[model samples]
Target: MTAALFGHDGPWTEEEYLALGETRQRVELFDGSLHVTPAPTPRHQRIARRLGNVLEPAAEAAGLELLEAVNVRLRPDRIPIPDVVITGPIDLDQVNIDAADVRLICEIVSPGNAATDRVLKMHYYAEARIPWYLLVEQETGSLHLYREKNGHHVEESTAAPGGLLELTEPVHVAIRPERLLD
Candidate 1:
């Protein structure tokens, strides 16, 4: 069998996981298991980019940086790649951001990622104590925003279609669900 096909099988240590480096697919390690997903589709990528653009200025103004393609380490064996993350300053060579440094995490829900993004990731981020969470359901044109309170995530705001979702905590920024993919 080709190494690429079965190389990542079985349990993975942090070093081996990180050594996979930059692959076309998204690879994550959690609970000593490796989870791999195909690259984001064009539509998915567009939504991520547009959303990143919307949050860039606000993040910078808040003394944070909006980033993607960076791993957020929640535990020694728990690491996942968020679609978007607003974090404190980072060294350019760093491959991971400590959960404590992450201010906000955004995940865009697509047909393939709905369950993971909405349920698993939500639970994990809250467990990591990430202060804010934004869930964008693309097909429905809706946005679900949450904030961490008492170490748990609480729904803070939501919007549908052209509706406006305004957030003031962690940073001040307003987002319209429809504009995220435009």
Candidate 2:
């Protein structure tokens, strides 16, 4: 009955993917496949929270909002719940938002899925033409900022340990990477 409803013979459509309701893990729809990722660790939550705190003021000043773990539909067939995102005012009742509304998307690297964040998602976000992508590596307590140019992402800045992550685009904010962890 379930398979019949979703049509297993063809690629999952946007309607079918959105109808997934809720699941145990983070699920993203890309092309004809579903990308499932395990739940984040408590530490991952902490970093996102800390980043939001520091970024909120600047984001608000620029008339953008900092949101965590919200679904962003990059296209009719691509939607991924980015860990953190900065966007213009949104309808609170919306289930998800268009990627065009997103000013910056952040992904915290899961310990075992570093490549997914560093390589795979980077490609997706870049391909989606998102202006900025921020990656936080928990193991090294480092932050890497990439700016999309042409059709790919280029490293714009990096902050690690005693260094500071500073940026003027998307929003103007600066903070030490160590503060994000502790």
Candidate 3:
């Protein structure tokens, strides 16, 4: 991920990060350091919105909630804001959702932050034992679904634009990659 490190000499604690409060930019805490990113581009936001819309109905039917850009506290030292998340019902006043409540986490690949999404974040989700991880490669219009198996994530399926992405766990649903881009 292309992150602009803060001028601080050392990593910030979780309490310190929370004290910063909400800001215009998106900030994630990883490895005790803060990884800050600018607001998403219009295209990125559009894709995220569309994907959320496509998933909401199915999620609701399965008693899951679809939320966007919410902080997920994976560990005491790690809090990553996924682009889209499917989880059990969360209270409106909740500051951050615990990893245990998360059913699925999705990251829409940003050109500059591809590695963070595909590598670092993927590992973090696996380590947290999150059930499902979805990776949407924006440029390629592809979707990848990873399932947690034996404490690690393994690719269970992949679909290209106009292809169907089917999921059986965390709620059964089918999505088309093109719908997310459109």
Candidate 4:
């Protein structure tokens, strides 16, 4: 179910991928291959921003850093830019933040790249041992929170527009799915 957007002819090294700087589109590395996705739509950006607004104060109260669209180096060959990440303090100058510093990673599912957000990225985040993963469905205005257990992800909870999306691990926060959609 994975698409080979780049490195179709052969595998690519991490250094080679990094050299292609400031792309207009989003690029990710998986298993020594490159996956490029188009820029997110305005709606997607709005949702991500709203979710960040809700999370920022909670994260700050818990003494965690809230970041958006930052590169996470899960491994030398695997670097994925998560839409939202809550983690410990990080050095801004670092090329890519180590996955070990990450506590929770959230992705706003894009209409065109839903599979990459729901499937591929889920597998990669679980493999990285990130404690919590949040999947925000752009079309349905729902949120699915998964927790890592035994090196895999288990659906911890889910909420629709009226329901509250609450989390205790990584940080304590409560948000409504409807707010994320607006």
Highest lDDT model number = 3
RMSD of each: 1.8, 2.3, 2.8, 3.3
Ranking by lDDT: 3, 4, 2, 1
The candidate 3 region of ten consecutive residues with least summed lDDT is: 1-10
The digit string of per-residue lDDT tens for model 2 on 57-169 reads: 99999999889988898888888888999998888668788888888999989888888889988998998899999999898999999999987999999999899989899
**Per-residue lDDT of model 4, residues 1-182, tens digit only:** 12333334678778877777667688888877778787888898888899999999989998899998888999898999999999898897887989999999999998888999889899989998999999999889899999999889999999999999889878888989999896
Error of 2 at 23 (Å): 3.1
- Model 4, residue 35: distance off in Å is 0.8
C-alpha lDDT values of all predictions:
0.87, 0.87, 0.91, 0.88
Q: What does candidate 3's lDDT look like per residue over 79-119, in tens digits?
A: 99999999998885888999999999999999999999999
lDDT of 3 at 53: 89
Prediction 1 global C-alpha lDDT: 0.87
Q: Which residue pairs of candidate 4 clash? A: none
Alpha-carbon runs more than 4 Å astray in model 1 = 1-5
Pull out the clashing pairs in model 1: none
Work out how many backbone clashes candidate 2 has.
0
Q: The CA-based lDDT of model 3 is what?
A: 0.91
**Span of 10 residues, lowest total lDDT, candidate 4:** 1-10
